[model samples]
Target: MRHFNHLLQRLRKIVAVALLSATTAALAGIAPAHADWLKAESERFIVYSDGNEGKLREFVQELEGFDRLLRLRMGLTVEEAPPRKLPIYLVGSRRGLLQVSPDLAENIAGFYMATDEDIFGIALRDQTVNTLKHEYAHHFMMQNFAYPYPGWFVEGFAEYYATVEIEKSRILVGKYNQNRAYWLQAASWMPMTELLSKRPLQTARNRDSYYPLAWLLTHWFVGDPDRQKLLSAYLRDVGEGGDPVEAMQRATGLSPTELSRTLRRYMRGPMPYQIMTLSFPQPPVTVTRLPRSANDLLLLNQRLKVGVPDDRRPATAEEVRRAAARHPDDPLALLALGHAELHFGDAAAAEAPLQRLLAMEPDHVEALQYLVRARMEAARDAESPEEAERLENEARALLHRAYRADDANYATLLLIAENRAGGAGSPNDNDVTVLEQAFTLAPQLGSARINLAQVLMFKDRNAEAIALLEPLVNDPHRPSSGAREMLLRAKGMSEAEADAEEAEILRQGEAEDEADGEEPPTGN
Candidate 1:
């Protein structure tokens, strides 16, 4: 069990957009002298930090600058933000970060999680900002382009932009990755064939070489204008299942050994950086210091709300409960306690604090949503039909109230749709509209996309559902989020391509339908 949990944490490091940090001398902490937390809001991010206000403001400007740089690179003309704002917790130290993700590796300085419910990033502020920037680069990639990129290219692309310098005059990109310089010097070079053909390797030597080599390869492409065009074509082919090594050789007109030789020589001299002199628009940043009512509970709330290992959650829940008890009037404390209860089961226990929070702040979107979930889950498990109906009715009432409070709240809209999706009847047009709105609000949330697809297929809108499932199945970071199974069910792809277990589940459903003397629905 311990080994399995360790493996799970390692898996989380990769999938959670976790940032691995090298050793560094301890710099002065970002925390302010006072025991207070600052919440900074900008166009793209909502950052919480127990740090100097000036430093945190500068930090946010750098973040905004990076966002703009990425947009400029992609030629995104509109300055409109992505669907949802990413909440980032700039934990003041490495130890502070560990409180957010206890089982995560010690060297992992930062991480972000995009769960079905929400998205957030957490990082230690002691090191340079490269770690968070690299992880955010991955998030940016996930948001914009989600083709089945080869693992090497995915990491490489992030690495290329990882070492950023937001200067007064200009922004510098394509800078060298000084973090892995030691690994690059010490580790044996991976042959071009091995480098180009494989996804990502975990062997000690391969691990040492992977990031540096990938960054070098990516830099080589970025530096040469003509090669950039060829690289695009090569990636397209690889996305369509072409052999990476073969495609690379075809694109560059060089054999594996020759290409390797050229890359080595290309790095012999000091590498060039692409400096963009574009004006970075400074978005308005609002920083609010938390009142003592909430300030004392911020870290504990963040630790619980961000995430924790399953084994530690029970203990965490106990702590939250105690905190809530102490600060009975504090909304943050109550919200955290309620979240822990709902997340760890005992939906009944979740209702008290959530209800308490709602009574204090009646229009609180999160509290309303939590209360609705508790009621809905209780309805599901209600032994008596009368109790079930009563619970569901109350849930619907709360959803209506929640909608009135904030129609733009995606979680509220999603909950509204889900509240009706599990009935004996099929989804109505209204439910479909709600789901679509939720999807538009947070296409980054896998659940929103999946829920909409499920409803689309049910409505025999197979084409639309397939359109959604294809990119989902092709997503390099999270390919196995039931998208392929969904595609198979919609007949988006062939039965031969579908997983055997998925096929069996469908066959079982058909068999059950036949036994029940009903015609099984057909897929397109």
Candidate 2:
């Protein structure tokens, strides 16, 4: 098995290299170009495009169609208002899309990426409609379905929806995908048993073979009523924790050899398309043409700098401030400026922009949450006790509003837990519960782990604290001296000795913040 895995990995690498070579050859004459981006807002989508108005309209129409078809076919009820809107970026050229994400550009038409906050898409202008439908299908499945779906089913479903046809008043679905058919015709098919049992990594390793084959199999299953029943039963069994290969065999009552022979015959014959036309009332859409500067700010705001050091953060903040100044009334510009100020540790400076944003969008959850932090910082810096109390009260009120707007916000939950832990005395039972909830929501967040560990130590749950702190202390990306000190205390150091060491660390932190003209830490 180890040897087989090694061979598979090597084969994947070779295939990847060949694909990249092909893509590079195809894109030889394509030069990267920048364009002014425009924004369009529908009920469920916020599309950023550098394309013409007609192309943008087509994109909106196709997305609405995809949205309707996915919900209808998947037996999902339509919601009056979706909880979250997906953002789509339509770059004018393939080169422009590459500029947005160079690492993923090779041989990719488009992609959908989900962050902690939202799911979004980036696609080339020429392929905007098709790519949006394809990526949105994936996003819809992920967001709607809780159970783990097979990779073949997931990609097949996405490919099935990718080929959409928009008519005058309706949209056509399940159109024949020529690309997949071409690949299917060219490649030798994998045996049904092997394909059904393939893990995600294995399938990904042979995607050129896997994707087209999966699409073909899915097309065959859904096109024929008897096969569709078998597929449904197989999926049901798998969802109920049955072994997928066994489930397939039981559902279809076919041997592996028989299945392989049937699949080959199915692929060789003229394929029947299971096309459906769907019509639904789409919500009103609002389109706006943003300036080039605003587009740049939008990209900057969305860009993730996870392990990378960002020395230009201060300069970026300055540029965002200038943009905010020029477009003072624009809520997005103000929101960007507020985030920039917060990133740069100027919570006081963050207040005005955030407040301005709130005035424009009163129920903005993020703005409300940031305002809480900003107010807390101001409270810490308040010279008078009365002023401090007032600011704290205001911060607490804003936090309540933020919670009302979106209680599932992990950051807001963390802040509430931290405030509860830091106030008056040690963390209480409720504080521990909230911290645990935040940790559960986003276990990857080191700060949440560290904060929870601190509370665990206060509660004399040394074992729990140590368990939480060990991984964080060893993590190279997250250097937490506080966690290290807390770990020592959790391991049975004297409280006075631990306090002295922690105080020194806090003093150093304070000095660094002071040198950087940053506010003192307010236990956030």
TM-score of each model, paired residue for residue: 0.77, 0.63
lDDT of 1 by residue, 57-107 (tens): 889988988888888786775486887778888877877766666677867
List model 2 lDDT by residue over 290-383, tens digit each.
Answer: 7545555665555431111367567667766776676656677777788778766365688788888888888898788767777777778899
What local lDDT does model 1 show for residue 452? Answer: 92
Alpha-carbon runs more than 4 Å astray in model 2:
1-38, 78-81, 94-102, 169-171, 187-194, 202-207, 291-293, 304-330, 341-363, 371-397, 405-524
Clashing pairs in 2: none
Global local distance difference test of model 2: 0.67
TM-score, predicted candidate 1 vs. hidden true structure: 0.77
lDDT of each: 0.73, 0.67
